[model samples]
Target: MTQTVDLNADMGEGFGPWPMGEDAALLETITSANIACGAHAGDWDVMAGTMALATERGVGIGAHPGFPDLQGFGRRRMQMPHDSLRNLVAYQVGAARGMAASVGGTVRHVKLHGALANMASEDAAMAQACYEGALSVDPDVIIMVLAATAQQEAAQALGCRWAAEIFADRAYNDDATLVDRRLPGAVIHDPEEAGARMVEMVQAGAIITASGARIPTPIDTICLHGDTAEAVGIARATRAALEAAGIALGVFPGRR
Candidate 1:
């Protein structure tokens, strides 16, 4: 039997009075919800409301932290000292955990968002900063990343559980990283096309990048970015396809 993979989505992007994605609707489809902390695109009310909704749906809760760049939505990288970055990540994770606990649940994992995650994947110094930040907040919270890069290895070495994540709604590079969004055909919005790509990856343990190259990546969790216009539809199709192909979807609990 093929091993099952979890379906996760980044959600809870609302900030202050500005509402973003349909988080409640998306939560119904995803097994894990990476709720945004106040850093990238969430505030107190947003976090609390999202937590309550996710808990009600029985979706696993995760802290989605990013650089403090609300304007760019944390997609634009910001250079900061290692200490500052660590402190910021820790603060965000702590806030999310507190909010989740208030809803009679707790954060199960931590996943960095946007530029912060991309930069930390290969940067040893930055990766350590984020990993330590997570461990400092909750030693047991699994850290999810796009691949098994140095960040993933470092987190494991520190006894922190980590999940190697892959995207079902986007193209990838030969290196197993996501294809640049600026490139043509980077985002897979079509449900059939996206489901086919994901089924191939989960069954064959490889993903064919937009450049037509096969990249082998052991993916434990698949990401479906909720901010996409077709997020809900794509998620539904992807889940149905995976189940049809005999890939059960659930959160990949790490060492903890």
Candidate 2:
């Protein structure tokens, strides 16, 4: 049997007065938290609160750096220069890092969010730029990335620590990439379905797509989207089911 995997959740997307998810409950179920910086849908106050909650719950802290597209939730792709991209990434990461530090915590990792992450997955140049940006911020921070993608390869090549991420609430294509969001059956909304998917990935090291094709992957960490419908329920169920399958969640053991 393979070693147990960690389970992570994207959180802290709330921006002043607008809240999202049951942060406390999600923290209890997840071993790691990818707290959104102000770029997407978080502010300084929200970041501080999220970091504090996660720290108290003993969850590992990760900076979730996204494009500065709060209106579109950082999902809309935009043309950005390498230097601009680098600064944006660094800015968001530092924002989260500062908040975590204030709460007697430290940022353990960095994960690019939304369109930025998807672009980095397929674009070698983008991956290189993002990795360099993350290194500039904190050279030792583990970079969470989609397994087997260009981003993951580039991070490894640069001697940057990384975690191979798999999604519990999303379906994958034949090539192990997430299915298009607009497509039917792209997202696993049912809590039971989401939980089963996580268990299958952990135990079998494979993810089944909507077309019934199995894609092999190393699920070092499983991600549950904190903004999905019934996200709290899904996260709790997925974590519980994974544990029942003998998979215990924790930080991925990577270089400091």
How much lDDT does each candidate structure score?
0.84, 0.85
Candidate 1: pairs in clash = none
Q: What TM-score would every model get versus the actual structure?
A: 0.95, 0.95
Task: After the best TM-score superposition of candidate 2, give how far the Cα of residue 20 lies from its true spot, in angstroms.
Answer: 1.4
Model 2 residue runs over 4 Å out of place are: none
Q: Which portions of model 1 show Cα errors greater than 4 Å?
A: none
Residue 141 shift from truth in candidate 2, angstroms:
0.2
Report the lDDT tens digits of candidate 1 across residue range 138-256. 98788887675666666766766788788888777676666677888888889877787889888878667777777676788889889988988988899999999888888787742
TM-score of 1: 0.95
> Model 2 over residues 85-149: C-alpha lDDT tens digits?
88889888888888899999999999999999888888868887887887898988999988767
What's the lDDT of the predicted structure labeled candidate 2?
0.85
